[model samples]
Target: MKALAWLALAGLSCMAAADGQTQFAQKANATDVERYEYATNLDIARVIHTENIPDDICEVVPIHIFYEDSHGERHTLEYSVMGGHF
Candidate 1:
């Protein structure tokens, strides 16, 4: 019972979507993020940056996503390497 509780607690630490994969929340939206899973023309790299601004202004630190992608191909995205940040 205690082991099961531990597992449940660990799972709660991550947010899961319909795909049942754990993902971190990004400050940017879909438009800001570029997805490239299987591409032949682009080698993209992203970095997630966070900063606290002065005067009560919070800076949006974007997430950094890095992966490879091909041209003119339908690529499925996953939690590990899917979208780009910043």
Candidate 2:
């Protein structure tokens, strides 16, 4: 019975760690997308970039990000200049 308790605890810990890792991955993917988008205007002007990608699949996905300026002016920028597929 004691052994089973230990096993259960260990399993729970592992699951928690896995969940944390998954969340971290998603944030990382979003960051990568932002970075790529920012890089587009790195040599031009000031730009802010961001994205929402699931952590589990973020690493396995190749994201195409472009900059979005919310200053009322409407324009579509190509984010593929710094293209990369995670």
| TM-scores of all predicted structures | 0.21, 0.22
Q: For model 2, how does the per-residue alpha-carbon lDDT over 1-86 read when each residue is reduced to its tens digit? A: 44323322433343423454444434444424333333243222212222333344424433322222455331222232222334
Local accuracy by lDDT, each model: 0.29, 0.33
| Clash count, predicted structure 1 | 12
> On residues 1-86, what C-alpha lDDT tens digit does candidate 1 reach at each position?
44323322433443223321112223335554553233323322321221111233244322233222344222222222212232
Q: What ranges in model 1 sit over 4 Å off? A: 1-25, 43-46, 49-86
Model 2 lDDT, residue 17, Cα: 31
Ten-residue stretch with the least lDDT total in model 2 = 74-83
